[model samples]
Target: MSDIPPLRPLLIERPEDEGAETPATVPPVPDLDIAVPPPRLSRARNSALTRFAMWVFGALFSFVLSVAAWDFVTSLLARDSLLGWIAMVLVGLAIVTAVALAAREMAGFARMGRIDSLRTNAIEAALKADVKAARGVVSGLGALYSARPELAEAQVRLTARGAEMFDADGILGLAEQELLGPLDQAARREVEAAARQVATVTALVPLALADVATALYSNLRMIRRIAAIYGGRSGTLGSLRLMRGVFAHLAATGALAVGDDMIHSVAGGSVLSRISRRFGEGVVNGALTARVGVAAIDVCRPLPFRTLPRPKTSNLVSRALAGLFADADRNEKVK
Candidate 1:
């Protein structure tokens, strides 16, 4: 090996040399920018520790409340048996109600899980071209929506023609066209409504952080409704899970931020940006909401977009903001 050279500073230090200048840091900017973020649930740096603390503290607090209740009931009993008995019964009922609510939450989670498994099974069957498994998936889908009067005709049609299809793709595709067609339309409507709401609020609301709160509320409600539309019937916790899943997918795919594609699609040529900056921010926010809604549909829908076409974020945003765009154009022309 040849002689090795040691690393050295670019300039030699000298006692008499003037003090070197420190590198300047970039100035901090506000998060509420014209190109906005659809609000995300923030996490602590030590997320695991935070979760542990939450559960431990929750359990201790609950236990303390329970002990206090029991003591109060016992003291009342010692004072007067009738009032104590009534209070005891009321407390017991409350406990039972809480247990029932908890059970309902668990059931909601299980329902969402069932839909997920159903989707997974459908994908597998479709890929393998397994007629039998596809039929099973169809049967499950039918059963899931059997209670709905609106699906009665679709259900009957599916059951009658399902036996005729010999391949998985055909079976699932037909099921898609029949069973999920109307449901898809309803879900699309929900997404549009959410996108419109988000865009309108973001553009008009001048208060700091107001847009963030509105976006969160609208997205959460939209997601929950979409889940219900797809037969997920998600409860509070289930809805939160769906929200996390939707946003996480967006983040993982790096689709969380607005891009050139979204900008062109939303405005048809950056027209919104020229019309009004705040309105432009609103438009971007609305587009992001549409993206989130589409992702929610993907997560909540039992079947993948193998047969049916998935909703495009562009198309949805364009239609959602058509009225707003027209209004903005009219105002621009008036000026």
Candidate 2:
């Protein structure tokens, strides 16, 4: 302490500090230029009031439109009898078409319900091992497929061999083999096709929200077609229900995610991962679509996948994107 110098306060200052004056307002913060985040699933909630409001509005609008149309037709008729008759006829035709469309939609829902009933019956038969119930289920299955001209031969084969079975397992197993085999292939093809389309569109299209729209449309069509293949033949609303059910199951089971399966499925293991960001995202979207397809199959198939193995996401994705990479490579070489 004796050898040390005395402490002193020192203020360091720049030469320009005295002349530089502060501005009236603070300077704005600089942007870091970080990348924008990927879009997430919508989490908007619809309250009961919101739903009721929509229903009320729709009803009022529909009533107003109908009244206006009726008034227009009646006024036209009052002015000119021939023109009025023509207008009336046109309105009658429109009403008939509307009725027919509603009937068709109802029938579609009925068909979807029928598939569900068959699935339930199948589960009961399997659980109880009831031969009688199994036979009934098989009969219903045959009847269901009889309308499809493509399955006529398979139905015949099912009918011919279905009588000899004694045990419940054998009867349903035979039905699974004969009747549902072709349908399974048909459904798998649909899944692969949809996955391929989704991946292709996502990889190539650079527009905003393009992948989202493609995935939604592709998954919807895929579900509807898969339902049709299983004799559901769902209409727009039925298709939406099927889509919802499939996604619900996925959510409940925590299957709504990507995994190592994606790496293995798209373009020869990990090779495609390094190719392009768009291609990688495309693979993920496609893989998810394939998952939805599998779930749709489970929802729509009359009998559960007992004899036939359920499709794996990786296997479906591999087959789907195999040709995609080949075409991409060709394009690169050509360019």
Candidate 3:
């Protein structure tokens, strides 16, 4: 009894219901900053330098002519009459040869310039037509889809016409033919591949409608930036028109989730108003315009503009738009 009493005196205990939890500590997150290089100015400078060099060469020839003229006058005055006459004839002959050589070299260049101009015009025209056609198809499909959203069968059926219109081969038929068809094998393949992709992407009109709409917006913004850097020129009107046509088509199609009223409002704006925006910077800014201009000089140039390098870029939206009518005249493919 004495041993048990001694242990009982130490009993002091709390109530049973205490709840406690240790909180978890979180690690801090680090912010990452990535750096991208500035866009390439080399390509632009190269193009400008090349044109400047052509002008310089032309200027040098003029200088040579001036020197010859001065020499001819002095020789005539001194009149070792035979020597003067002989030197005069030789100078005339030399001038003629130089001119002939320059003309021969410049002919190809002139043709290239014209091709650039005409091809650009053709691209603008084709885009306008495609946009118009696309709008009609989109409007028709949108109306059908809106009224009968439940009818999946009807939706697919309605989209088929627009999709066909977007077909790559159908689009190719709109390009300048003679220039594109005779391209070397590798170049031809690249163009064909691009054409195929455009056609396939286009055939999914509803999806393309959204893509086109988004891309058009992005492209317009980007083009303006390029134009600011590149500055405006005559051919730039065509490029701006190309963008306008795409945006107009997308607006007309009612592709975005925006209300019908907004779509109609946008489409109501004058097409010309949209087209009058700025164009690109750099040396080859109107290069396509030059090429197309030359192509048009030929009567057999065909309906669609053709022959030219397809411009590729890290900027995908502008690149796609640029490529939209790229193969119109096949002749411009890089060899």
Candidate 4:
């Protein structure tokens, strides 16, 4: 058998094999045609609504004023008959105005209250810091002075009287007056020692506390400074005097406390005489107590509820009237 004989079909050409478009193909995408409203109409509508609301308000306001004016004119023409009515209306308006003014003033006063509290807090903080520094200084001075109190007392007395005790001319002159001759070698050494002690003590103490003490020496000083700030200067002189007396009493008490603290500190520390020699008994007694008192006094000073004297009601009324008159006078001058 011959296996070479197989029948093959003829080659056919397909038009779809070429990259040509067929008759059944759909068309490409068409351009979009959207209809948008004009923005000018929306803006115009908003403006028209706003104008209508404003016009309505203006018309209402004008109508109210016109009615009030008409009534006012009618009452004036009927003067004798409507006098009471006009007065009543006037009083009503005055009352309303007064109430509104009072409300506004009350709001302002409330704000002032907050500011006052803030100022008080600031003053308190500053005072505390000052007191702490002063306590350390005074305590150190107390220790130095305690070592030789006789000399310290003399110097303190001189300082109180505002004498120039520390200066070379003052010291030499005073020493000559007290001793009545040139200092012998031993006497000179003793005077030198006392002078040195005084200097040391003064150096240790704060000048600021001294400044405060000098500023507040009398009732007059206290009243002037305090009353000015608080707006109650009418009875300032009496207030100042009372405050000065109180301070003096307190200072005496403080001195006693200082002595007590010194005695306690010395006694409590050690049973041995050697221990007592270094830190005396008075040291502990006032050491903590005096500082505590100072802290308490500082805290009380700036409080709103102080027990200061008040002016009498009659006086207060007179003062108020005077203030009004003064204001009227000033207004007249300005005009």
Per lDDT, the best of the predicted structures is: 1
Write model 3 residue lDDT over 7-59, tens digit each, in one string.
45567787764454335444443211111111211112358788999899989
Which rank order by TM-score, best down to worst?
A: 1, 2, 3, 4
Q: Rate the local accuracy (lDDT) of all candidates.
A: 0.81, 0.79, 0.36, 0.35
Candidate 3 vs 4: which has more TM-score: 3
Q: What does the lDDT read for residue 107 in candidate 2?
A: 89
- For candidate 2, which ten residues in a row score worst on lDDT? 33-42
TM-score, each model? 0.79, 0.77, 0.27, 0.16
Task: Write the residue-wise lDDT of candidate 1 on 179-209 in tens digits.
Answer: 8999999999999999999888888878999
For model 1, the stretches where C-alpha displacement exceeds 4 angstroms are 1-65, 80-83, 268-270
List, residue by residue over 150-219, the lDDT tens digit for candidate 4: 4465445433432333333333233222221211222222222322232222223455454223323322
Decreasing lDDT order of the candidates: 1, 2, 3, 4
**Where does model 4 exceed 4 Å of error?**
1-246, 249-262, 265-267, 275-278, 281-300, 304-335
Candidate topping TM-score? 1
Off by over 4 Å in 2: 1-67, 268-270, 326-335
